[model samples]
Target chain A: DVKVTQSSRYLVKRTGEKVFLECVQDMDHENMFWYRQDPGLGLRLIYFSYDVKMKEKGDIPEGYSVSREKKERFSLILESASTNQTSMYLCATPGAGGSYGYTFGSGTRLTVV
Target chain B: SQQGEEDPQALSIQEGENATMNCSYKTSINNLQWYRQNSGRGLVHLILIRSNEREKHSGRLRVTLDTSKKSSSLLITASRAADTASYFCAPESGSQGNLIFGKGTKLSVKP
Candidate 1:
């Protein structure tokens, strides 16, 4: 089975602190994505990377950034954590042209205090 | 902006009953997918219906898409207690390789 592993399941960070969430997929997928899910708001994309070292901002990329330094790993960074940033962060990888469904990582619930 | 919205924020049913959820999107899409997510876990892909296809089925799950209406529906027949989870509908929009997910409908199946 394909696996998408997230570095943390739960995290707490102070305001203004920098945070990192890691995701790795073993499927050699070319596309990786980061999303933040909130109650009543659904999952909003923060960023996505289609290839190694290439990234693009999604709808809600205000305070978040992404890095795809390796083909199998994608990282989401919170430059300055804030209370509003508290939410469930999900990572997913999709096959080329979305021919197959995405494989998601166990989300990380972040609480910014 | 959110591309999709799911109707009926929550639903409850007895085991062996059927459950249905609806999703509507604002933009054109290449495909619509249904996913199941247990509490605090990653989402499991259930089914995907292409824009050109009207309906698709897998096991007891049925998915229908109406491109003209920009809507989709998921139906699970003879739902089991294990079917209790949050169901989300996502649309593959643009070429950015990201899925736009709906808020999800929480389903509870009691034995």
Candidate 2:
């Protein structure tokens, strides 16, 4: 069974449209992270949530927001999707004891036209 | 800047050949780990080597760490086309469980 699953494997949106990418985990996790991967750029953290209703800004949080209302669900929102924002977005959840180096989702390839 | 940067951004090798990838870090670390990613899929954890250790092996993969030189290497023996993927080295850093990942080395193994 897949433990962490992203809502969409591929997504397409207009340049000014608002987009939402979802991640759901079945295992008990204390922390979650959102990252974007681009060619030649690797992975850059966009947001991280330590606990329910708590979140932190990562290295590149601009134009993106996150919501963690429940323990198992974390959502990444793009307020106004831009063409440059088109990239593969990944979500990771570490172990319950605060251990990292966790597994990543299959990733959502977002394309903002 | 404490992360490990992979060398030789891209590599091409034939099946049955051995592939080696190197990682150079900027600072001291307690441990280092390697990961592999297929084309568009998520990364899979490969191996983890502690600072005090010299080398570790699993299956056809071997990892070596030299803390004094702040460098690490991953060796994949008897490679196959299925082994074609991007390899990343992560050096554990600081207090939190922050793993720094640089641009990975993309490997292409031809059958």
Writing each residue's lDDT as its tens digit, candidate 2 over B1-111 gives 256899979999999999999999988787888989999987777888888899999999999998889999999999999999999998877766666678999999999
lDDT of 1 by residue, A1-72 (tens): 678999999999999999999999998888898988888787888999889999988888998888889999
What are the runs in model 1 whose C-alpha is more than 4 Å off?
A: A96-99
TM-score of each: 0.94, 0.93
For candidate 2, give the lDDT.
0.87
lDDT of 1 by residue, B1-111 (tens): 336688889999999999999999988888888889999888888888888899999999999999999999999999999999999998877765368887899999999
List, for all models, the DockQ compared with the true complex.
Answer: 0.74, 0.52
The fraction of correct interface contacts reproduced by each prediction comes to 0.76, 0.46
Q: Compute the lDDT of residue A48 as modeled in candidate 2.
A: 87
